[model samples]
Target: MKPIRALSNADEVVRLLGSEGDMSPAEIAERLDIPRPSVYRLLDGLESIGLTESVPGSRARLNLRWLHLADQARESMVEWAGARELLSELVERTSQTAYLTVLRGHEAVCLEWEQGRAVGVLLLKPGRSLPLYAGAAGRTCLAFGVNVEEYLDTVTERRAYTADTLTSDAALRADVEATRRRGYVFSDEDVTDGIAAIGVPIRGSRGQLLGALSVSGIKVEYLAKRDAYLEALLDVAGRLASLNEAAIQ
Candidate 1:
């Protein structure tokens, strides 16, 4: 089915404002390749719904409505009620930043994180996201989640963030296979230089893929404690899964 032109343009407007910050309707029109008049209508519609607010310089930006929605969204994830403590525990054991990410469409969304003593330029903070081929958390989720081949078909671009980042389809598929074999991912400076991460899948009681659990830090420190970190991740992921199952029961 074909997309509705107005709705598609409106969605692009929201995404543009979100990613590029405040922008005038003309700027949005130019960026999105839509008509300036259509941009005005979209902005008006969004502002009427309190999704966008006018700032100085005739620019528009997403408003506090998103924060309210975000709060509601966070509260809805009842199964993850005690996940923060678990991530903190993982951080304590490994001295590396711990992340909990769930696959959302084509991206891995970081739902939560616990900063560690050895934290570097961590990228998987809460609310941020990564392509499924990029980070440890993303790769682990991609490997363990359903319809792996279908997901690969949707990926048109495999961007390389660093020298070690896998940009080829074969390399990504190989990494996914390796992750399935080992039950975890050992990402060595894949997303960012000097940063390494270890990832393991979190499953529910019915063996459904729930999310990914990961720890990241400086390369040498991460590699040095690789075995211990993997053990800690697996232990915490199991506990989290049990918690979710018990919640449902």
Candidate 2:
């Protein structure tokens, strides 16, 4: 919420709109924990830049033009993050689909993904938005980068997607701490039953979290290849982070 972080907040606002569809200024301010006036000003800047649009009394949504930029951003980030080749290697090694996702506001946005020949799986499609609380991707974002308490408090929809989903505050906080300590995260049957995923946060040399690399498969398959998946994610973390800042600049 500081003035210096305005651009970062603006970037997050775009991701927020993507996750929630569309929102009023009041809704945005509430979700983002920023003042209404600041939200309005932010919205104004976005509109000026043609990233979003609002009718007088309606909720503001990302302009269609934003989609074009989003597509470009994806291509741009993949190249700089060195994620393309690494994701390919991941799928080849584990025969499970791999994903590279960025922590976007209260959700993790899929930036790039590759399919595996193992089980014909295809869940984490590009552009899909997932919760930043219940999956391996969420664990990395929560543990490594974001304001955990603020994220926990603001996110209202804690749907128990499956029997294994962790919805309690205490359980989730404990998992977050554990992820930090272990330097990785694993979610089994949390987002989807019969599927499991392992994730490692990608950090820059300066220790800033860039995003996460996760691989998912049928639970048995993932468990068998867990060690390999962790190693693959670790191998590219530095490359992704080192080039991410340059990509954005």
Alpha-carbon TM-score of each model against the true structure: 0.92, 0.70
Candidate topping TM-score:
1
Residue range 73-177, candidate 1, lDDT tens digits: 877899888999999899889888899999898889998888889756556687779988888988987898857778778887788889998777788789888
**Candidate 1: residue 203 Cα off by (Å):** 1.1
TM-score: model 2 vs. ground truth: 0.70
Candidate 1 vs. true structure, TM-score = 0.92
Instruction: Give me the displacement of residue 202 in model 2, in angstroms.
Output: 0.4
Pick by lDDT: which candidate is best?
1
Residue 104 lDDT in candidate 2: 84
